[model samples]
Target: MDTPDTPHVNKERIDTMEHLSAAIGVSRPTLSRYFQDPDNVSRTSRERIRKGLERVEYVPNFFATRMNRKSTGMIGVIIPYLNDLFFSRLLEAIERAAMDVGYTVITQCSHSDPAIEARAAETLMSMNVEGALVAPLGNHSDLDVHERLRSRLPFVMVDSRPDTMPEVDFVGTNHYHSTGLATEYLARVGGPPVFLAMPRVNFNAMERERAYIAKMEQLGLEPRIVGVEGVSGAGYFEAHGQAVLEREFSSGRLVASSILCVNDRVAIGALRAAATHGLEAGAMQRGGLRIAGHDDYPLCPYTVPSLTTVAQNVDAIGRTAVARLVESIRAEKSSGKQILKLFDGEMKIRESA
Candidate 1:
């Protein structure tokens, strides 16, 4: 039984000292330098310290260690919903990139609630996190909280842009181009298609919707914008989309040869609805109807007929957000003006046209 005061620095732990020295082939003082600040030490010494730590099973008091450092070396990563593959992958890439830069990531999923997201950010801020990379809850973000954070810390927005608020920096996809790409791909292969989405209050979704309309008009096709409530990819909400589709299909009001979904997950749900209504959806070669999606999720390739979608440069967005946030923090400046950085999306043409 070891007490908090006494770390397991017993014979079992110390016996490895000789082996560690032999392995490292360095004096303990030299090894200590690596632990004190690996970046300051020679690469060889750092490697030796890493090997020694493994052999001796040492666990430094991280609390005391951070207390001694100039900065906490921590970053907060906030995602709207972790269940979505895109958000999850985005967070993972950000975490890995942050860790590589010697910063620890504390992640939180806000579950699509504005209050929850605000609380999450506030909580992380309370912990003295150096900065935050956040996927804000669209219009649900607490501007008051963000305004206060502006005075104390730096935060970068991802995925969704704040509306009419000029107080944040965003690293996200080129939603307009991506949606246009999806629509064009659909139009070229299966003729123009109706664009379906939830409300366009979300910044990304608004951009996507704009692209859809512009592209449809450019191609001389009438735009059919289908509106729904709630987010994409839920079973029940998708069922509602299916009902709408069925009504439109039956009424001959479906204006296009196919449909461009806001995302692969949404497309999957729409495809289910299409199938349930006995409409064939797949490759253009044999398509009775074509379906396209955006944000080529991990499951995009596995979906029925293997969805054709637009793949956002989420990895780049994550990397850019952290790098920018770190820079902004070091600069000690929050312009309270928004900076929107848009990364492009690649078109993944598949059997779904």
Candidate 2:
């Protein structure tokens, strides 16, 4: 029996990894691979090594290993906010894609603040990540942070990008064409829709708004933009939608028979508002307001009337972003050329509209 205060016991317990590897009946290199990433080792070897570690109470110093390695085999993913389902799903997809390539992922949230976004970028750079996929805060992001990152390693913008970074690579949904499809559908089936404008936060929202306006004008319907004042970020879309609709109902300003929301969350909020005003919302046959939204969120199917929306190709966006970054990493020299890839959205017509 070894006592806590015994120097002999301490020395015996603090065995080197080489000794542990022999004890576990595994080669030193196999044990090293397990320490770097358990998935790197075969299942049988991993289980044997894990049992050996438990028996000996031995652990590898990962921090020291990271410091010694020239490449960390890690990827950084940054998004504006995590509360939104759209972003959460996007992050999950990106992580899966990174893991498929034997790379680990670390994530940071900016909470839609420019200063916080800059800090996140700096932290990722400091960690010496092999590459990064970012969904910038558009006009609000710090240009200096992006420039510094681009000069150091491969970087790809997902979902959105800053207007200043013209040379950066981007992977995003085709907001213009997607919005046009939704707007045109609403006009063909029901009445021309009144557009619900999101807070001018990201380029995605701006492009959606522009598409809605153009589509309306093309259809020969006067475009009406309804916006909520003094609201931004996270739950802002839903809250703003509710507030605006409530005011419009009371003042009888909601003239259109159909409404097109910027995204599914806003459409959900609009549904709640419509219910409060004792107005059922769905197809025209249901004697309710016809409503449609973009970016079919995960919960859209379960909504009251089953929301009609444009489904963004989040999986494609995630896979493409990771592949592009990996390609850049393998390149001997940075091309300094820009690549913009946009996948079209599919319109899902359900009970709503």
- Model 2, runs deviating above 4 Å: 1-55, 59-61, 231-235, 284-288
Clashes of 1: 0
Cα lDDT listed for each candidate: 0.74, 0.83
TM-score for each model: 0.80, 0.85
Best by lDDT: 2
> By summed lDDT, which 10 consecutive residues of candidate 1 come out lowest?
10-19
Superposed on all Cα atoms, model 1 deviates from the true structure by an RMSD in Å of 6.7
Per-residue lDDT for 113-179 in model 2, tens only? 8899889999999888899888987776887888888787799999976677767999999888999
Q: Which lDDT tens digits does candidate 1 get at residues 225-261?
A: 8755653444433454565566667776653468888
Q: Measured by TM-score, how close is model 1 to the native structure?
A: 0.80
Name the lDDT value of residue 68 in candidate 2: 53
List the candidate 1 regions with Cα displacement exceeding 4 Å.
1-58, 229-243, 246-256, 284-287, 332-339
Q: Looking at candidate 1, what is the lDDT of residue 5? A: 94
TM-score: which candidate is best?
A: 2
